[model samples]
Target: MKVMFSAFVAALVIAFAAPMVLNQFGWSVAEQTSSASVRLD
Candidate 1:
């Protein structure tokens, strides 16, 4: 029972945190690409 409860909590935390983490990473990548100084000139 305790193991199941802990697993449920872990899943909940991951469900909530995953999106935020992914968003931050996506935004960082986008920012880097947009502000890249290595122009293909």
Candidate 2:
């Protein structure tokens, strides 16, 4: 049980921190996907 709990905590931390780390490198999801949208100007 203790090992499982630790693993869950580690996964949660990674899930939350990974985005911030990527954003630091300017690799945000919104910026990447926005380019694919049609600009109906």
Candidate 3:
């Protein structure tokens, strides 16, 4: 249970932090995803 909890926390941190790190490199992930979603509609 402890192992699983630690893994889950690590995943959550990565999920939230990855986008900011990528954005610092000028990767418009949110913009691209939003535009793609709009096009699908």
Candidate 4:
């Protein structure tokens, strides 16, 4: 019920907020988006 819904919201916040917070310290999380067209030759 309420607890489960709150936990889900908290998890969502952490997933997005954690990376932003960490990046402020000169760190970054790996991105795996499909729109990237990088190819190392």
lDDT of each: 0.84, 0.90, 0.83, 0.78
When sorted by TM-score, best at the front, the candidate numbers are 2, 1, 3, 4
Whichever of 2 and 3 has more TM-score, that candidate is: 2
lDDT head-to-head 1 vs 3, winner:
1
Better of 1 and 2 by TM-score: 2
TM-score of each: 0.62, 0.64, 0.61, 0.61
Q: Tell me how far candidate 1 lies from the true structure as C-alpha RMSD in angstroms.
A: 3.9
TM-score of 4: 0.61
Best by TM-score: 2
Which regions of candidate 3 fall more than 4 Å away from where they truly are? 29-41
* Collision pairs in model 4: none
Write down the TM-score for model 3: 0.61
Q: In candidate 2, list every pair of residues with a backbone clash.
A: none
Better of 3 and 4 by lDDT: 3
> For residues 1-41, what per-residue lDDT tens digits would candidate 1 score against the true structure?
99999999999999999879988778666665686466686
**lDDT, residue 23, model 1:** 82
